[model samples]
Target: MPSVLWVSLFMWSYQKLASVYPRERPLLLLRVSGEVVEVDEKLSDLPGLVNTSPYEKGWLIKVKLSNSGELNSLMDDDKYSKFCEGNH
Candidate 1:
């Protein structure tokens, strides 16, 4: 069944991750096991941090970016404002 296939894939992925990453740390330490983890150690107690500083200090993950150039497509504030203005 579809559910069985998904569960199998999930289990296989977890095992693969466990092997790839050191399991000495708790599996959910950062809600993941890896070399690069962004930790907002204060978020749980102050959930508004997500709204106040989403892209800056409040980021939930700190990934080792694979392609920095992908950011070129993102609009700057003026462009984003214009785009949003047109939508409303």
Candidate 2:
């Protein structure tokens, strides 16, 4: 149990730190019942986020953005970081 707690703590901290980097990109959008799903690279490794946050509880997919095109329309790391920070 203590190990689990420690691992959770580490993951949370790493997520926090990772939030500072502007790399997460929304690669796919799964629409169901007029709701839009945004998928990013994080989900590629951890697909559970999709089932858990399809819209707000199950995200559908993800993509890695390298250029400043439609990606600019998406949220930046600082913005996403702040958005998540507020949730916590």
Candidate 3:
């Protein structure tokens, strides 16, 4: 039987949503703005893709935006990199 290892909570539009963590890694808190439309099933079986090909094969889910306005608050890749640098 399959057992859950960990669960994480994230906020979207002030609502809380629970996401399951199937691997042994740090929990990532993400601010999401949409409804999940698809999940990458291969990640459950091949967790290494998360490290080996995160930008390509390791994507976890696909979402359809619930509110396009939320895009206004997001950071671009360059800004996100700078933000992460400052935080670290």
Candidate 4:
């Protein structure tokens, strides 16, 4: 059931939001901001922001890295750029 529940990010996110609103609390640590920050609570009301204004008005959450070491595991601009180009 755990694996089955791991569906699309939209589904998973909506489910999480139902139980725990992202705007009410910190979802995760950014590893760059170095602080715990809240998501744009408004995202719950307007999920379309994801497709409309993904960069600016549609931002999901904010965080500061609690551990900079974890930064290495995430995609950087170049890697993400290549990934987008290759996949799409």
Candidate 5:
């Protein structure tokens, strides 16, 4: 089974929250700032969900945005898909 890891950033400081064996290099998973209200414990048990059901059950964290205005700078689903295509 593939390894799973979870991290949290608070006030620009990085911390490792959880991990399984055979860690991989750090990757930018998401960028957001706010209180992390909840985490999906299910991910630790089902890491494959990150690839299999990303839009539904694979979400990493639930954040209550500190600045709702920050969302305006983020891409919607359509724009993000295009961005990924361009980068790839």
Candidate 6:
């Protein structure tokens, strides 16, 4: 069998119009659609997420981000690093 990357949301748009919409729980919202799997190292340059030069593309959602605010709550790169470091 082909080795799939095990993406949560397959070919989902980056930042969607709904992104601008107000959300209550971002993580919970993300799980609503597909399983909130591991986020990719690079962005797919898909339709939604305007594509930032992060790695390959600006991939935002591996799973569905139901609540708009959920995304907002996520920490920035620096904060995220801290979060990961603390957890590990």
Candidates ranked by TM-score: 5, 3, 4, 1, 6, 2
Ordered by lDDT, highest first, the candidates read: 5, 3, 4, 1, 6, 2
Cα RMSD to native, each candidate? 15.2, 15.5, 9.7, 10.7, 9.3, 15.2
lDDT of 5 at 85: 81
lDDT of 5 by residue, 13-45 (tens): 222434431243224344445676677677667
Candidate 6: tens digits of C-alpha lDDT, residues 40-62: 43333243333333323444434
Poorest stretch of ten by lDDT in candidate 4: 1-10
| Per-residue accuracy of model 4 over 15-45 as CA lDDT, tens digit each | 1323334345424322232453555667677
Alpha-carbon TM-score of each model against the true structure: 0.43, 0.24, 0.59, 0.48, 0.63, 0.28
lDDT of 5 at 66: 68
Query: Which model scores highest in lDDT?
Result: 5
Off by over 4 Å in 3: 1-30
Please report the candidate that would top TM-score against the real structure.
5
- Please provide, for model 3 over 1-88, each residue's C-alpha lDDT reduced to its tens digit, 9 standing for 90 to 100: 1121111121122223243355643344445455666767786777667557756776656666666565556565566667668878
Report clash pairs, candidate 4. Answer: 31-64, 31-65, 32-65, 33-64, 34-64, 34-65, 35-64
Task: Indicate whether candidate 3 or candidate 6 has the larger TM-score.
Answer: 3
Q: Quote the positional error of residue 49 for candidate 6 in Å.
A: 17
TM-score of 6: 0.28
The local lDDT score (0 to 100) that residue 38 gets in candidate 2 is 38
C-alpha lDDT score of every prediction, in listed order: 0.38, 0.35, 0.50, 0.45, 0.51, 0.37
- CA displacement after TM-score superposition, residue 71 of candidate 2 (Å): 1.5
Candidate 5: lDDT of 86? 86
Question: How far off is residue 48 in model 2, in Å?
Answer: 9.9
